[model samples]
Target: MTQQASLVALQERVAAVNDVLNATSVLTWDSRTMMPAGGAETRGHQIATLTRIARDLLLAPETERALEEAERAVLEFAEDSAERRMVQQTRHAVEHHKRVPASLIQERAALRTVAQAAWIEARSKSDFSIFSSFLAKTVELSRAYADCIGWNGHPYDAMVSIYELGETAASLKDLFKELRAGLLPILDDARSRPQPRSDFLFRDFPEEGQRAFGLSLAERLGYDFRRGRLDTTVHPFEVSFTRNDVRITTRYNRNYLPASVFGTAHETGHGLYEQGVDQAFTRTTLATDLVGLYAVGGTSFGAHESQSRLWENHIVRSRTFWQLHFPELQMHFPDQLGDVSAEEFYRAVTRVEPGFIRVEADELTYDLHIMLRVDIECALMDGSLAVNDLPEAWNAAIKRDLDLSVPNDAYGVLQDVHWSTGYIGSFPTYTIGNVMGAQLMETLRRQKPSLDASITAGEYSVLAEELRTKVWQHGRRFMRDELLERITGRRLDPAPYLAYLRSKYAA
Candidate 1:
């Protein structure tokens, strides 16, 4: 066959692999949100089988030759066009995939499944010991996976490359250091100031009303119900298989009014991004390879976090958002909100709460939660920490960082399910994403000062559209740094995030 024909065939093969991956993603989502407990073993086998298939297809020598040939054709014919971009992306993914052993791949998938089951059981019983052995094994597998990926700076950096390309531990450490310097003082100030009137936030709220408020908020933010659905999970997450089948799940706390509302808005931010990707790239090599390249479209885990945080904290917690919805809050909890003004409600939700649970943490204290997890993950991955000692270590970090004590393992080490799923070295992404979101929003505000008014008016189209144009639509066509610079004219600096915190809390 001619070289052009060979490249076309290679593209077809890559598309087929993505189709299998998308299908597998759907099953994985079900395993988390909808599947019954009895189906765990079968689900494990299914995920393992599919993972092996993807590994083998990407590892196949014929596909490797085809990819190389395709790259040559694109470079020779199109130079620096979209065709070459597709070839470069395909090559990059296969190179990393080739580095990871198939045995390790299958093992991680199987371990994650069983570990998830054990986590569900442990979390239900609030018993960390029940899941300790499984978690230990998961950590072991993650370390091995990290070594397979290889890194010059840190093993954690190698692991991070799986989710965020071209990011290093040193880079993140420097960013966090700058962040820490700015944040500690702001936190001190927040502590010194008169506390906001948050007593009203804990007032009795009906679950039905909470759900209605969340759905209405999501709709106002442009979440498409036809293409996506929201459900309740123990912990909230958004997982997508394709544009038409994105699912977001949130946990509802009846006692706390903002849990479901903000949680849904956060996950919806993720869902909308998934739904907004370049639709024309669907079912192709250009499609599956697109998401990780851009700085805005979760260009990094931090980029994704920015969207969630933007919606959850910056917008949802803002006085403007409440001004638009004080009536709704009154409708839901007339006894609670009738006497309260919008400013009071805003300050209440935005109160700086030092908490053990990361999900329940307020915006200011949230990074401390993330830093605590980052420390634990780093220790666990490097063999300095033990699974059995996790609770003590967790409490120690919480106390040192937030000056708070943990009352139980449920509220302490077992609060997050990330460890149960072989996702070591992933906790930093939450804080990093928060920083990225704040920085991006700063740039966005400069472009459109009326964002506050737009948010209050319940019109998020302009903001969402800007993100789609700058971040989401490009998919993974550019490197994270390249994309950030291209879109925002600045690198990914955590300083903006820190500045944002200082201005909000300290000022």
Candidate 2:
């Protein structure tokens, strides 16, 4: 076959796999959002069947043949070319999956929905016993998965690499060490100041007003509603079937105003990345996570988180954002925010308060929440911690890290849905996102001298276009570090993140 014909054949095979994965994503999104409680079991089986089908298709003889032909066809292409990278990535995923059994894949997929349902009930009842057995089974399957994939260091390393390639327990420890050192003093400085008047933030605001404001905020931040949407979920997340259909969900808290507002901004950031992917790569290997069996366009979980954190923190949380948009928000909730000023609202939202919830945490204490989760995940994977003892371990860590008492399992060990959903090693990505987002923003500000002015004027297209060119357009064509190095001339570093926090909080 000619090179073009060979490449086209491989693309067709990969696109089929992408379709199955996208179908799985659609079901997964439903299970989390609108599915009835009793549908969990059948949904689990359905997702498992689709996941197994996608895996089988990826490893079939036809796919192997096409991949071989594409490999030879793309041999003369540049190393960084999308054609070469697609073949290379597909081959890696094939090899990776071949080491694991189809039964194991099906089992893991089947457990996700059931376990998530159990987690919701347990959380609602503030009961860990209700979910402990499922969690134990999940940990066992995760261990088996790590063994199948083969790991030389901590078993958690294998899990971590599944989400963020090249990250391990040891490496994250080093990164967290540097971050903790820089953050502690800054936290102290911020805490010593007189706290902002945040009483207004806890006042009653209707869900209708919050949703209207969130929708406007998302649109203003460049989230394309034509190809995207917003909904409500227990945990906020963004999922994409392809670039053409991306959806985000955020929870609403009528008693706390920042929950929906910032949550919408964060998920909109994720939607923007998916919507920003090159249309030419749709349904191709460049737009699918072959290893994770998801039709996501971002290069990695951490890279995806970078966009969410960037929009959530750097832009939406800025003084300029509230100053420009606060009038609209006040118009929505004139009764609740009648006495509040824009500057006061900004200060209240950004106030550095160490909280029990990671999602609701302030910027200074957010990474501390991530570090605590990483430590517990490592212990769980290594068998140093027991499943039943999780609440105790979680409470101790929360007290030690955030200097707060745990009120219950719902507010402590059962807070996050990651474990139940089988995202064992994904927590670190939030902190990595913070660091990467700051680094990128620093580079962006240096390169675009008018960035602050544009932001102050509430014009986001300038910033959005720059990010689309630098970070989002390539999809999975580059690794996390490669994208960072290409944009900033360096790999992931904590200096910029620490500098940003220090400048914002201490200075």
Candidate 3:
């Protein structure tokens, strides 16, 4: 086929594949949000069948020929052509899927659906045992997955690369070591100092009021409700069918103010990234961050998480941010927050209390939660840790790191939704997000020194615009390292993040 014809063929095939994929996305979203309890098994099978179809379509013999032909033309015409990126995306998915059998891939998808429903039950009961069999199957499936794809000494290298491209067990260990050492002094100092007294945050601020305030915050921060939406979920997340249909979900705790507020802000960060991608890429394969294992590792989850962390921790938790929003918060619950000063609220929100929940952790100890998980995941990958012993190991790690005993498995090994669906090696990206978030902020401050003032004024257009221009619009056109360097003029550095934590938590 002529290269031009080949390029057209590849695009047509990818668009067809995306139709199956996007429909599957809508089903998955509905399953999570609106599907009836009795529909779980049938939905699992339906979603898996669609997943198999998409996988097979992507790896079709004709599609491969078209991609190969188009790739050559793309390189010859211009190395950075969008055509080249698309081929790279196609080739990555083809190669990864080729390693595993079609039936196994479908089974894994079905298993994930069942595991998620089981997790909700286990979490509600706060019983790890209730989730134990599902967890075991999840682990076994993960191992089978790694075994199918083949691995060197580190099976998790492939596992983590599923979410964070180009990252490996060795690289993360080194990064985590540096992070832990840097954070220790900050954590120690923050703990030694008296915490700000703002128990009013736990006052009875009705759920309806909290949700309304949270949605308003999301809208103010460029959420574009006409194009996107906010909803309730057990674990907050953002999902998108296309740029114009981004949806985010957050759970609420009426007695704990920060729960819904930060969760909404965090998911909004992700929504903004999705909504900001080049409109040209929407509804295409290059659109969703869920385009995992599709390329060598473009748009790392760490990079994506940085947007959520940046908005949730650095901006939303800052004193200046409260200067603009505290009144709105008080308006939501006057008796709960009317007398609370903005600085006091900021201090309360930013408080460095070490806790069991990773999502709700303070900035200082947030990464420490990731560190524990990284260690556990590594041990699981190496066969040093048993799946059944996870709760004991988790509790021990918590006690060692935070000096807190585990009261139950829900707050211990069963807290996160990642593992229920076989995302064992992905937890560390939250820490990576923290590091990258701070690094991005450092770069942003240099570019627009008045960015904080804009945030303080309840005018975040400047910050949103900067991130869109520098980071979001390109989507998978660049990998994580390439994106950071192109946006910040340097590679990832832990020093800035370390310094950021120290400055924020200094006694």
Candidate 4:
């Protein structure tokens, strides 16, 4: 077969795999959002069936033949060319999947929905026992999967690589250590200041109003409603079937204003990344996380989180954002925020208050939350931590790190939806994203001198377009460090991020 034809043949098989995965995503999204609680078991089975089918199709002999032919066909292409990246990533995924049994994949996929359902119940009741067995099984499957993937350092390294690719437990430890050194002083300085008046933030603002404001905020930030949407979920997330149809969900807190506002912006950042991916890459390897078996366009979990954190904290939480758009927000919650000024609101949102929830954590205390999770995750994966002991470990970490006592499992071990959904090693990516987002923003400020002015004027498209060209357009063709090096002339340095925190909070 001709080189072009051979590449096309491989792409066709990949597109099929992408379709099945996307179908699975649709079901997953439904299970999380609209599905009745009673449907969890059947939904798990449905997702597992599709997941196994996708995996089988990806590992088929026909796909191997096509991949072989495409590998030779793309040899003459540039190393960074999309054609080459497609074949390289696919081959890597196929080899990686070959190491594990198909049944394991099915088991893991099936457990996610049921576990998530159990988690929701457990969290609502402030009880960990309901979810402990499911979590133990999840940890077991994760360990087995890690062994299959073969890790030299810690089994958690294998799990981390599944999401962040190149990150390991050791590397995360170093990163967290550096971050803590920089953040601790800032946290101290910020805490020393008189706290901002945030009573208005807790006033009752109806959910309808919050959703309306969130929708407007998303639109203003260049989230295309034509290709995407915002919905309410217990936990906020962004998912895309392809570049054409991306959806984001954010949970609302009627008594806490920033919850939906920042959650929407965070998930909008994720949606923007998915929507910003080049259309040509749709249904291709560039838009699909073959290893994670998820139909996503972002290169890595960290890269994706960078976008979310960038929009949520760097932009939306900035003084300029509230200064420019606070009037509209006040219009939505006139009684609640009418007496509040823009600067006061910004300070309230940005105040360095350590919180029980990671998603609602202030920027300064956020990474500490991530570090706590990573420590527990590592201990869990290595058999040093037991499932029954999770609440104690979580509470201890909170007290040691944030000087807070855990009120309940709902506010402690059961807070995050990640572990229940089998995202074992993904917690560190939140901090990674914060670092990467700051690094990218630092570079962006240097490259585009008008970045601040544009953002101040609420012209987010200025920053959005820059990211689309530099980061989003390439989809998953480049690794996280590669993207960083190409754009920032450095690879995942924490210096810029630390500098950003220092300037914002300490200095």
What is the C-alpha local distance difference test score of each model? 0.76, 0.95, 0.82, 0.94
Better of 3 and 4 by TM-score: 4
Expressed as tens digits, the lDDT of each residue in 141-168 for candidate 2 is 9999999998998999999998899999
RMSD to the true structure for each prediction, in A, is 2.5, 0.6, 1.9, 0.7
| TM-score for each candidate, following the candidate numbering | 0.94, 0.99, 0.96, 0.99
In model 3, which regions exceed 4 Å deviation?
A: 1-4, 288-298
Per-prediction backbone clash count: 4, 0, 0, 0
Candidate 1 per-residue lDDT, tens place, 1-507, comes to 676786787777776677667767777788888899888888988888887786677668878888877866775656435567777777877877777777888878777777888888888898888899999888888888788777777677776666666666777677667777878888888888888787777878878888888888888888899988888887888876666677788877878887888889899888777778787655555557422211122345656676788878887777778888888868877887888998888788778878777887888888878877777777787789888898999888888998888888888888888887777766777886787688788888888898767776888898898888877776655666676687678777787788778777764
Candidate 4: which pairs clash?
A: none
Q: How many clashes show up in model 1?
A: 4
**Residue ranges of candidate 4 with Cα displaced over 4 Å:** none
So what's the TM-score on candidate 4? 0.99
Please tell me which model should have the higher TM-score, number 1 or number 3: 3
Candidate 2: residue pairs that collide: none
In angstroms, how far off is 87's CA in candidate 3? 1.2
Per residue, candidate 3 scores C-alpha lDDT tens digits across 169-206 of 89998998898899898888788888789688888888
